[model samples]
Structure formats: C-alpha cells, structure tokens
Target: MAGGGIGGALGGLIGLACAVLPGPAPIAPVSSVDTSLWSAATLERGRQIAAAGDCAVCHTAPGGQTNAGGFALETPFGTVYSTNLTPDRETGIGTWSYEAFQRAMRKGIARDGSHLYPAFPYTAFAKMSESDMMALYAYLMSQPAVRNSPPRTKLPFPMNQRPLVAGWNWLFHDERAFVPDETRSAQWNRGKYLVDGAGHCGACHTPRNAIGAEKGGFAYLTGGSAEGWDAPSLVGSRAAPVPWTEDTLFDYLRTGFSAEHGVAAGPMGPVVAGLSTLPESDVRAISHYIASLSPRVDPAVSADAAAAHAVRASAAQTLDDEGGRRIFESACAVCHAESGGVGHFGVRPLMGLNTSVALATPDNLLHVLQHGIDRPATAELGYMPGFKDVFDDRQLAELASYIRARYAPGQPAWRDLESASARLRAHAH
Candidate 1:
C-alpha cells in the first residue's frame, strides 16, 4: 500500500454511453422522475468535492467549455471521451433525478439504464458515502447544460461490446460501503477509506489478472501492469532519496514534491495538481489513509525498521555489482548523488524511493528508464527529458534488474531487456 501517499484516483467520468444511439441497450436505466431530495447545502458541498476530485480536468476538453463531454482519454483500447453530465434534457443529464445520478456514480449505470464502463470509476466512487454522493449529484446539476452530443465511441472489437462488461464488473466491483475499523486510529482508518474509496488508488496501483480483475492476494498494490503506463508500487517503497515519511508525503500532496522524490509525473501529475488544491485536512486524511494500507516489509532490504535504514543505506556504498549500486551509478547516481542533481529537472536519488524497490517487477523502472519521466509540464512546471535515447535496452534491463534486486530485496530478477524491448514493440499499434 502507498501508506500515506495517493495513487491519484480519478477525475472526469469519461467513457462510452451507447444505449440511446439508434436504440438503447436493455440494461439502460430509465430516469427516475423525482426531485424531493435536492438540497441546497448538499449541492454546494458537491461542487466543492467535485473540484477536489478535479472533475472538469478530464470531462471538459481544451477551449472554453463546461461538460461538453468530449475529452478523449487515450487508453490502450484506443481513446475514450468524457461523458455529458450537464442538465441538458437531450445530450446531458437534465432529465436525471437525484437517485438516478447517485446510481450512476455508485453503480456505473446510466440514468437512462445503460451499464457504464469501469472507465467511469463507479467501482471506486461506490465507496463514497451516501451524503458525499448526494453532494456530487447536486454539483453536477448546478453545472451549465451543454446540448452538444459527443461522437459515438469506437472501442477495439470485442471490448467495444457491453455484455463483456458485466463479467468485468462481477470480477472487480465491490458494492459495499466503507466501514471504518474502530481498533485502528481514526486517522489511519480515514486513510484507509480514502485509499480504498475516494482515493481509489488501488484501481491503478494494484495489478490485475488476465481477466483484468485486481489480482486478489499479494499483488493488490504491490504494483502491477497498467495499460498505458506501468503502475508503480506503493508497498514499503523508499523511493524518495529521503525516507517516505508522513511529513514528506504531506509536502508532495500539497506541493507535488519532496526534497527526495520527483514531482508527480505521468498519469499521477494531473492527480497531484488536483490534490495540491484540496483542503489540508483532506490531504492529511488522504496521507493517513495511504499509511493504513496492508503492512509489509521488504525482506531483501535488510532495514525493516526505519531507524535501521541508515545502516542499510551505508552498506549500499559497498554494492559491488549489486542491482542497487549498478543502477544508481548508471542512470540514477548522476542526479541522486548528494549534490549530483537537485529536483527531477535535475536529479532525485534512488537511495530510499518506495517507488524504486517496492514492486515485484521492473515495469515502473523500465518505464522510467525507457521513457525517462520528469515532473510533467504545468504552466510553471519544468520539463523532464525522455531517456529512451540515452539508455539502450540492454542497459535499461540491467539497471532495472539491479535496482529491483537491491531495493526490493527478496524478489528475484525477472526482466530481460530483450524481452522488455519485444513487449514494447508488441504494444505498438
């Protein structure tokens, strides 16, 4: 588990909605024409929560717009766009009642009775409480209605079909609401709720089986293969040059940085930006939440206790051809060596990155090495150069193997650069 760091759950409920095109699907939910529960306070809170969730960032495409519903999400399955959530009677949800709206957010069902794809994150949103869900509904209703109809979706072949989705839901969806554990600290439990619910971090952080359900046991946020990007692990990650402390995590969520780690980049960058604007209490809660995930210790790392870390770190200096030392020198040492580099635009070291040594494999490492992620670009953000050109496949493979072996501890080296290269090629369209 991220243990006090977020995996940047979700934003716009972007996805395919095919029920009403020529003819609606049978599962399409008919609108419930009721308005008895639309409360003003709830609507206001919903708007605030929506902002915290960064709904517009994904739902609204570039150019001045509000719920225009056509921001294309470039996934491994081609591209998907944001849905029309405004109150337009036709193109938007003008006809949707509070119950219908709540159902869509919680159940991945459309007001018109269609099963929403998991791309909308109803699985994660389902963890939200009834009050919070109502607030969200109010916020959506308050938004300006756009009559613009989005283009029809074109998912790749079999995945394009909807029936296949029911099975996917059966495998992944958990409808039970979050029930706090009293034995744990309130903060810890809060962290748990956020991680499992609002943070929904596991949807991405956890690996999936061939059928795409989250691999039930150990693979659960120990990290896994994501479609467009390799999901990094949140397990006893010591990825930051400094230790992964709550205070440091607080800084990263608030400012998108800590002295040791890179600013949020890739898919996480946008989510970080969303977090930076959230309430400190919520951020702290999220931190607390991440900290409460299932406990673990990297057997290979030798330093189970944080206090023992320095000793283990010292031992790293003696890494002869160990994965840690070799990787540090080859790709990471330049920026990470005490004064070698500063921030990501400069260098963040590999000594204690949880992101580095926590995973069972090198997908994240390979991605960073092969693609060379830097802090993603914001208006004032700096750029990170892609390093696919700098390191060849063999070197990346070696470096990845080296880092994972050294930091991840018990895990055996499993990546072959030749194989990694071949997979990259295979993924290419």
Candidate 2:
C-alpha cells in the first residue's frame, strides 16, 4: 500500500488531471538570466547544486520513474508526491516562466499562484538567492521528461482543502531571504546557505510545532520525529554514549560508516546512501554547515555525571541469565556477527548502535523486534521489513539482552516489550 503498485497508479491519475487542466500554473514566472551565463562548467556546478537539493530521492517513484512524480511523501496529515519538474509540455514544467518557478521554489506557491503544502520545503528554500535559483532552473530544464501522472490524494474533510494553507503559511513560514552574518567566515556562511536553503535537511531533522511546522527560531538543529525513527540532534553536545566527531560524521556521510557512527538506518539510511552518490566536496560542505552549529547539551544529559564520561556505572544490567548468550548465538548470530552478516535488508550491526543500547526505554528496539521493522518504513526506494510475529516478549528480551552486552553500550539491560510495544502502536503513523 505504501509503494507504487497502488499508490503509483493512483498518483499517475492525479498527475494526468493536473497536467491536462487549462489555466495559469500554480507558480508565477521568474526573471531570466542571459543564456550565455550558463556555460558548461556552470552547468556542471548547477548539477552539483541540484544534488544538494536532493530532488530525485523524494520525487522519483519506486523502480525509478526518475522525475515523473508518483512517489508518496507521508505526512502527519496525509500523503503527497513529488510533482513533475521535467520540461514536458503537458506533464512537466515546459511552460513555467522564471518568476513562477522562483515563487514556487521560494514561497511554496505553485505556477497557478495557489499555495502548496509545506511538505515541499519552500520555506527553507525561500532563503536561496535568485541567481542560484536560476541555476537550479537550468539544471531541471536539462533533465529527461517522464509522462506519468500521479494520483489525486484523498485528504480527510477540511484537511483536504487548500486556501487554508495560506493562513498556515502566515503563521509558520519565514518569508525573508538569508542575511549573511559578516562576523562569520565565508565558508561558514556558505555552509549555512547550503544546509538551510537548497539542502532542506531541517524539514525532517528539526522538531515541529503542534501545528506541524518546524520550530524555526530554535537553534534549528534539535531533533524530533513521530515516525519510528528518532532523528538525533545535530548539535553534538548531547552525551550519547556513541561519540560523533567531525571526522566521524564526515566519514559516515561519505562512505556511510565511521567508527563512532554506523551506516544510517531507517529513513536516514537511504538518504545517506543517496548522498554518497553525490560528490565528496559537497558532502564535506554539508558537514561544514552542520559542524558550525554550537552543540546544545540537553539538561538531562548535561546533568548526568555518569553519561558525560559515557560510563555505564549506573546504567542497569539487561540480563541475569546464563542462557542469554546461547540464545543470541542460535537466533541472532547470522545478522549480528562480526563477519559482516548485517546487510541492506534492515539487518544492522545491532552492536554499538545507540538505539539498541538505549534499553532504558527499549521502546524502539522492542517494537522492531516484536513487529519486525520497516527500514524504509514508508516504502522501498528504501526497504526495512517489519518483524512483529518473529519472536514473543520473553525470547526477544533474552536475545536483546545478550546482544546489547556483546555489541551495544556496556552493562546490557533487560526491558519490558509489552510496555514498549504499546507505546510504539499508539504513536505509529
């Protein structure tokens, strides 16, 4: 249901309707740049710049419709798809003027001048410069056009409506262009622009308000999520038992591994894998941007003297059983062993992963073990399977307790899967 077979067919129908409609496009025209301004080198730069925007990862359909717009973007309110940005006369942006493109990209308005749902992160992009905007347009103009139409989403009652989106915009969106802080070095400012503007990483990584818009005025990198994956804070000051240094974060961003951080899991896993395809320089730039943020130490972490040293002195033990180790060897060794048994099918190292070790709460780990986990929970494009029926509470606890000791933080601890399962069910999207 989450992937194309049904969603794609439905989305394609919706795309056809929107493409066939006759009227002003949802966006307005953008000002022109001299064609001479876009030379071969500039086009290449534009291509790299385009990757920073990460368009294909969100817009393309499963089994790859490249830019044809049939993939579903799940939200707390409803699901949406990446719109066609191809130059197709009917199914894409063939007739869009520069001004309209700018408005849509920066203001969340469509060529038709209608408001777009914030699921598209124009609020962050609104900070991008007009020149860079031209570059993006050039890049998009160069891509191949696919003719598929996506489904017309069926939203519940009032949430289905649009005009109200304008009001939502006024309350939550920031309309200003970015102001460079002269006090900061040029590299820092460039990093800021890339992350806050074209990258749009904050759209998912940042915490949201009751109304679901980002809590913008905050340092802009504290983490929050409703999906099973909890985006850790980027601030880096939090005393996670696993330390994330610049070198560590950079390696993970580039090759998807660092001694401190493992390959990304959940939604982040796919994102990093995609980012890995991008040039290393751009990835480094992204690191520069994130590293510039002052690490904010959470009160809970800052006040804990034990966690500061990452010491497990006070953390509870997960097991009291002699059979714990044998249970793990029999049931989990294939995926958790050092011979690299963990592969792309949601089998993570399970060792040294912070989530596995966080048995204090145990909600995330238990939910995955009980129900299995959907790695790319929304769909493949990224795939993580669910395992609910595989093991009951007691077996899971035994295996989990053993694995945590061998691989996760020190002093492996046992937990109540019943309580964890209930919490996961109540909050699952």
Q: Best lDDT goes to which candidate?
A: 2
Ten contiguous residues with the weakest lDDT in model 2? 376-385
- C-alpha TM-scores of all predictions: 0.68, 0.73
lDDT of each residue in 134-241, candidate 1, tens digit only:
778777876677887876677765556654465456546787888988888887776676667766677778876544456667676766544456566666553333
- Cα lDDT of candidate 1 equals 0.59
Question: Which residue window of length 10 is worst by lDDT in model 1?
Answer: 5-14
The reply for model 1, stretches above 4 Å from the true place, is: 1-44, 51-54, 57-67, 71-81, 86-89, 144-151, 155-172, 215-220, 235-243, 260-262, 294-336, 340-354, 357-361, 369-381, 388-414, 418-429
Alpha-carbon lDDT, every model:
0.59, 0.62
Q: Model 2, 288-358: lDDT tens per residue? A: 66866755334344335323323342234555554666765666556655445545543244344454355
